[model samples]
Target: MTNLLLALIYLAFISLGLPDSLLGSAWPEIYPGFGVPVSYAGIISMIISLGTITSSLLSDRIISRLGTGKVTAISGLLTALAILGFALAPNFWVLCACAIPYGLGAGSVDVALNNYVALHFKSTHMNWLHCSWGIGATIGPYVMGIALSGGGSWQSGYWYVSCIQLSITAILFLSLPLWRRQEPEDYGANTEESPGSDASSAHPRPLKLSQVVWIKGVKEVMTCFFCYSVMEQTTGVWGGTYLKLFKGMDAAAAAAFAGMLFLGVTLGRAASGFLSIRYSDQQLIRLGMILTAGGVLLLLMPGPAIVTVCGLMTIGLGCSPMYPAMIHATPQIFGREHSRAIIGVQMASFNVGMFVMPPLFGLIAQHLSVGFLPVYLALSLGIFALMQRRLASLYV
Candidate 1:
C-alpha cells in the first residue's frame, strides 16, 4: 500500500510537469499563428506566474480545507481543462485566459505535494519524485514537436497532453482513499517523520508573511530562491526562442531541443537521489552551484550549436538537487514548526521571480536580441551563488 501510494504521488507530480514546457516549445509557431509579437509570450507567461503566485500564497488554507487528496484531484482536473482550453482557443486572448487556471492549478498542486512528500516519504523519494516531474517536463516538448511536425497543429499537442492530464486526474480521484487512510504524524522529527502521513496541517499554523520575512536567514534564503527561480523559469520559457531566432533552428527542431534541459534534469535528479546517501543537502547544493557556473560559461562562449545545446543540459543537470535539498534543509535551518511556512514563502519568492523576469526578458528580446540570454543567465547564476553563500553562512 505504501509503495502504491508513493507511485500515485509520483504520477501526480508528472501531471504537474506535463504542460510546463508546451508553450515555450510551441511559442515560435504559436506567436506566428496568433499574429502576436514574439515578446507576447511574456505576457502569457506573466499572467500564468501571477495566477501561480496567488494560489501558492493561499495554498495552505486551501489544502487545510480540501485535504491533499481533493486538492490534488481538483487541481489536476482544472489543469486538464485549461490545457484543453488552449487546444481549442481561436485567439491569443483565449490562450491568455487559459493560462490562468493552469497557473493556479500548477502552483497549488506543487506546494501541496512537495510539502506532503517531504514529510511522509523517504528523503530520497522526494528527490526521485521530482525526477518524475522532469520526466513529464521532458516529454512535453517531444509531444509538441510531434504535433508541429508534418504540418500538424500545435493544438494537437495540447490536446494530447490534456488527455494525459485527465487520466492522471482520475487516478488522483481514485487515490483519495489512500490519502484519507494516512494519519498526520509529528512533523518535528529531524528525520522524515514516518511513511504513513499526509501533509494536512503539516506545519503549525502559518505565520503572516510580514513575520516570516523577518526570521533569521529568511531574507538570504528567499533571495536564493528568487534568483534560482528566475534562471530556471527564464530558461524554460525562453530557451527555445533563443534556439529558434539566434541559433538558426527552425520551429520544429528548436521545439524538440527545448526538452534537452528537462532531460538533463530527469537524469540529474535520479543521480542526486543516490548521491544523497553519501552527501549532505548543502554539499549537493554546493556542487550544483559549481556546475551551473561551468554551464553558463559554456553558453557564453562562441561555439557550435551542439555546444550551446550541451550548455542548456548542463545547466539543467546542475540545478536538479538544489531545490529539493533546500526544502529538506528547512526544518534544520528554522524550527520544524516554522519550516512549512518558510517553505511557502520561499515558493512565493520563486513565483515572484517567475512573474517578473520572463516578461522582462520578453521586452529584452523585443528590443534587444535573444542573444543576450547567456549574459542574462550568467548574471542570474552569479546572484544565486552569492545568496547561496550567504545562506550557507547563516545556515550553520
Candidate 2:
C-alpha cells in the first residue's frame, strides 16, 4: 500500500512539473503569437520566477496551515486554472497575468513536494523523483512540438497540457486516502524530533539577511548552484529560441531539440544518483561541473546538427547531478535540522540568479549576436568549476 501510494504521488508530481518545462520551449512560439517582443517575453519569465520566489519563501507557513496533501491539491487546481487562462488569453498582458497563479502553483508544488519526498523517502528516491521531473520536462516540449507540427496553435497546446494536469490532480485526489492514512514515518519524519518542534522552528528567524553563515567551502557550493541555475534556466528557457533564430530551425524542430536536452538531463540525473552512493558527492559535483563547462564550450563551435545536439546533451548531463548533489551535501555540512531552511535560502539565491541571467541573455542577444549565449554560459560554467574547489573542502 505504501509503495502504491508513493508511485501515485510520484506520477502526480511529475505531471505538476511539466508546465514549467514546456513553457521554456513553448514560450517563443506562444509569445510571438500574442504580439509580445522578446524583451517582454523575458519580463514575463522574470515575473513567473518572482512569483515562484514569493511562494517558496512563504511555503512553510502555508504548508503548516494547509497540510501537504491539501496544499498539493489546491496548487494543482490553481495551475490548471492558470493554464486554461493562458490558453484563452487574447493578449500578452492576460498571459502575463495568468503567470501569477501559475507561478504560485508551480512554486508551491515544487517546494512542498520536494520537501515531502526528502522527508519521507530515501536518498535514492530523490533521484527518481527528480527523474520524474526530467520525464515531465522531456515530454512537455515534445508534446508541444507534436501539437505545433500538426498545425495546432499554441493555445491548443496549452489546453492539451492542462488536461494532463487535471488528470494528475484527479489521481492525486484518489490517492489522498493513502496520504492521509500513512504515518509520519512514511514521509521521512525523524523519529527523534518532537511533533511540535518543526512548527516551533517554522517562524521566520528575524531576517538576518546579511548575517548568513559564510562557512569555508560553503561559498563554493553556493557559487556552483548559483552558476548552474543561471546556465540551466538560461539554456532551458532560451535554447529553443536560439535554435530557431540562430540555427534556422522551425518551432517544432527547435522544441524537439529542447526535448532532447531534457532527455539527457533525465538520463544524467538517474546516473548521478547511483554514482553518488558509490562516490563522494563532492567528487560527482566537481566532475559534473567540469563536464558542463566542456559542454558549454562545445556549443561555441559552429558544428553540424548532430554535433550541436550532442553539445546540448552534454550540457544537460553536466547539469543533471548538480542540484541533487548540492541538496545532499547541504545536510552533511549544515546538519539536518537546519537543512530545510538552508536549502530554501539557497534555492532563493539560485532563483535570484536564474531570474536575472536569462533575460539579460535575451537582451544581449538583441544587441549582439545570439552566438554570444554560448560564451556567457561557458563563462558561468568555468566560474562554477573554479568555485567548486573551495566548496569541496567544506563538504568533506
Candidate 3:
C-alpha cells in the first residue's frame, strides 16, 4: 500500500510537470498564431501565475477541507479541462482565460503533493519524485515538437497531454482508499500526519497565513524560493526563444534542445537522489547554486553551439535538486505540524517570482536584448545562494 501510494504520488508529480513546459515549448507557434508579439507570451504566463498564486495561498485550507487525495484528483481534472480549453481556444483571450483554471489546479496539487511527500516519504523520495516531474517536463516539449513538425496545430499537443492528465486524474480518483487506509507508521514517522491523514482529527486547526510567514527563517526561505523560481521559470520559458533568435537554431530544433534542459534536470535529480544519502539538503542546495552560477557563466561566454547548450543543460541540472531539497527541509526547519502551511506559502512565494520575473524579463528582452538572460539568471542564482546561506545561519 505504501509503495502504491508512492507510485501514485510520483504520477501526480509527473502530471504537475506536464503543463509547466508546454506553453514555453509551444509559445513560439502560439504567439504567431495569435498575431501577438513575442513578449506578449508573458501576459498569458502572468495570468496563469496569478491563478497559481491565488490557489497556492488557499492550498492549506483547501487540502485541510478536502484532503490531499481529493484535492489531487480534482486539481488534475481541472487542469486537464483547462488544457483542453487551450487545445480548442480560437483566440488569445480565450487561451488566457483558460490559464486561470490551469494555474489554480497546478497550485493546489503542487502544495498538496510536496507537503505529502515531505511528510510521508524520505528525502530520497522527494528528490526522485521531482525527478519524475523533470521527466514529465521533458516529455511535454517532445509532444509539442512532434505536433509542430508533423504540420499539426499546437492545440494537438495540448490535447495529447491533457488526455494524459485526465488519465492520471482517473488513477487518483480510484486510489482514494489507498490514501485513506494508510496508518501513521506508513507515513515517514509514528505521528501519522500525512496530508490526507484525517486532517480534522490530527490538526484540529490549521495555521493561518500570517502565523506561518511570521516564523523565524520563513522570510529567508521564501526569498530563496522566489529567486530560485525566477531562475528556473525564466530559463524554461525563454531558453527556446533565446536559441532561435540569437543562437541561430530553427524553431523545431530550438524546442528540441530546450527539452534537453528538462532532460538535464531529470538526470540530475536522479543522481541527486543517491547523493542525498550522503549529503545534507543544505549542502546539496548550495552545490546546485554553484553549478547554476557556473552554468550561467558558461552561457555568458561566446563559444560553440555545444557550449551554449551545455550551459543550459548545466543550469537545468543545477536547478533540478534545489527545489525539492529546499522543500524536503521544511518539515525539519519548521515543524512537521507546520509543514503544510509553510509549504503553501513557499509555493505562493514561488509563484510570485514566476508571476513577476518572467514577464519583467520579457519586457527587458523586448526593449534590450535576449542576451541579458544569463546575466539576469546569474544574479538571481547569486541572491538565492545568499538567502539559503542566511537561512542556514538561522538554524545554526
Candidate 4:
C-alpha cells in the first residue's frame, strides 16, 4: 500500500509538470498566431502566477477542510479543464481566462503534495518525486515540438496534454482511499525534526501567515525561493525564445534544446537521489549552487549554439537538487506543526517570483536585448546563493 501510494505521488508530480512548460514552449508559435508580440507571453505567465499565489495563500485552509486527497484529486480535474480551455480558446483573452484555474490547480497540488511527502517520505523520495516532475517537464516541450512541426496547431499539443492530465485526475480520484490510510502524521511524527534540533517549542499550533513570516529565517527563505523560481522559470519560459531570436535557431531546434534543459534536470535529480544517501541536503544544495553559477558563466561567454545548450543543461543540473532539498528540509526547519502553513507561504513566494520576474524580463528584452537574460539569471543566482547560505546559518 505504501509503495503504491508513493507511485501515485510520483505520477501526481509528473501531472503537475506536464502543463508547466507548455505555455513557454508553445508561446513562440502561439504569439504569432494571435498577432501579438512575443513579450505578450509574459502577460499570460503573470496571470497564471497571480492565480497560483492566490491559491497557495489559501492552500492550508482549503486542504484542512478538504483533506489532501480531495484537494489533489479536484485540483487535477480543475487543471485538466483549464488546459482544455487553453486548447479550445478562440482568442488571447480566453487564454488569459483559462490561466486562472490552471494556476489555482497547480499551486494547491504542489503545496499539498510537497508537505505530504516531507512529512511521510525520506529525502531521497523527495528528490525522485521531483525527478518525476522533471520527466513530465521534459516531455511537454517535445510534445509541443512534434505538434508544431507536424503542421498541427499548438492547440493540438494542449489538447493532447489535457487528455493526459484528465487521465491522471481519474487515477487521483480512485487513489483517495490510499491517502486516508497513508496520512503520515500518525506514523512519523518524528519526521519533522532533525537530530539535535530544538523540539521543546515544536508542537505549537499551526501558524498564521503573520506568525510564519515572523519566524527568524522565513523572510530570507522566501527570498531564496523567489530567486530560485526566477532563475528556473525565466529559463524555462524564455530560453527557447532567446535561442531563436539571437542564436539563429529555428523553432523546432529551439524547442528541442528547451526539452534538453528539463532532461538535464531529470538526469541531475536522479543522480542527486543516489547522492542523498551519502551526503547532507545542505552539501548537495551548495554543490548545485556552485554548478549553477558555473552554468550561468558559460551562458554569458561568447559561444556557439552548443555551448549555450550545454550551459542551459548545466543550469538545469544545478537546479535539480535545490527545490526538493529545500522542501524536504522545511518541516525540519519550521517544525511539522507549522510546515503546511509555511510551505503554503513558500509556494506563494515562489509564485510571486514566477508572476513578477518573467514579465519584467520580457519588458527588458522588449526594450533592450534578450542577450541580457543570462546576466539577469546570473544576478539572481548570486543573490539566491547568498540567501541560502544565510538561511543555513539559522540551523547551525
Off by over 4 Å in 1: 27-38, 145-152, 186-203, 236-259, 302-306, 361-375, 393-396
* Residues forming the 10-long window of minimal summed lDDT in candidate 1: 189-198
For candidate 1, list the clashing residue pairs, or say none. Answer: none
lDDT of 2 by residue, 80-173 (tens): 8898888898988898899899888877667666665555555456667788887786677778888899999888888899898888887777
* TM-score of every prediction relative to native: 0.85, 0.80, 0.88, 0.87
lDDT of model 3 at position 322: 93
C-alpha RMSD for every candidate: 3.6, 4.5, 3.5, 3.3
Model 4 lDDT at residue 122: 73
Candidate 2 at 21: error in angstroms? 3.9
Model 3 agreement with the true structure over 31-125: per-residue lDDT tens digits: 88889888777788888888898999899889878888889999999999999999999999999899999989989889988987877766688
Clashing pairs in 3: none
Better of 2 and 3 by lDDT: 3
For candidate 1, give the lDDT of residue 230.
72
Candidate 2 RMSD computed on C-alpha atoms after optimal superposition onto the true structure: 4.5
Which digits, one per residue and each the tens of the lDDT, describe model 4 over residues 319-385?
A: 9998888888887777667777888988999888887888799888999999898999989998988
Which candidate do you rate higher for TM-score, 2 or 4? 4
TM-score of 1: 0.85
Stretches > 4 Å off in candidate 4 = 27-39, 143-153, 184-206, 240-259, 303-305, 366-371
- Candidate 4 whole-model C-alpha lDDT, 0 to 1: 0.84
